[model samples]
Target: MYFGKKNSEEPEIIMEDTIVYACGSADCNGWMRKDFASENYDCPMCGSQLVEEVRELPKIENEYNAFK
Candidate 1:
């Protein structure tokens, strides 16, 4: 059984596949997830380097910059 949220009841089960990755930077507590088929996968909160390996989010000066 899946651990995360499930899709609504439907004739066909559409499981949304995602890849969770940790930030490549240090001293940051951020996490990110990207579509399994996506080519670009970066931290949503902070534009930091991300790798397939589990890591910690790098410390960022400003988190709002990402929104701008």
Candidate 2:
């Protein structure tokens, strides 16, 4: 799990089960993952170029039933 920097002005909400994939390239430490929406994200770690590679990842469901 990764902890983002906090802002004192806003309420703090903990995020769980946020899965992010690191770049397969050994030299590049870029990472890609879905955001709140199920859209493909580019590199969020190193801002490196991204390629569309189909991956079989576990389905993520909202435990709070927010989508339902």
Candidate 3:
């Protein structure tokens, strides 16, 4: 039997204030990163209009932005 090693050095979670679009409907909890949002701010899950908001989220690359 092989024992797994415990790695103490882990990448730190880098949080940033990012723009996002969230569902306006109280019944829905759908949200998405602004960079990934479409021109029409509509919830793809519940067909609710989305509102822009700032949220603290982890840093990630917006692959869609790469083309621009």
Lowest lDDT sum, 10 consecutive residues, model 2, at: 33-42
- When sorted by TM-score, best at the front, the candidate numbers are 3, 1, 2
lDDT of 2 by residue, 11-65 (tens): 4555555455555556786655443323444455565555544445555555555
Clashing pairs in 2: none
Candidates by lDDT, descending order: 3, 1, 2
Model 1 quality (TM-score): 0.35
Q: For this target, which candidate reaches the highest TM-score against the unseen true structure?
A: 3
Q: Which 10 consecutive residues of model 3 have the lowest summed lDDT?
A: 33-42
TM-score: which is higher, 1 or 2?
1
Per-model C-alpha lDDT, please?
Answer: 0.54, 0.53, 0.93
- Provide the RMSD of all predictions against the true structure, rounded to 1 decimal: 13.1, 11.2, 1.2
The per-prediction tally of clashing pairs is: 0, 0, 0
lDDT by residue (tens digit), candidate 3, 1-68: 98899798999999999999999999999999999887988899999999999999999987779988
Stretches > 4 Å off in candidate 1: 1-19, 33-38, 54-68
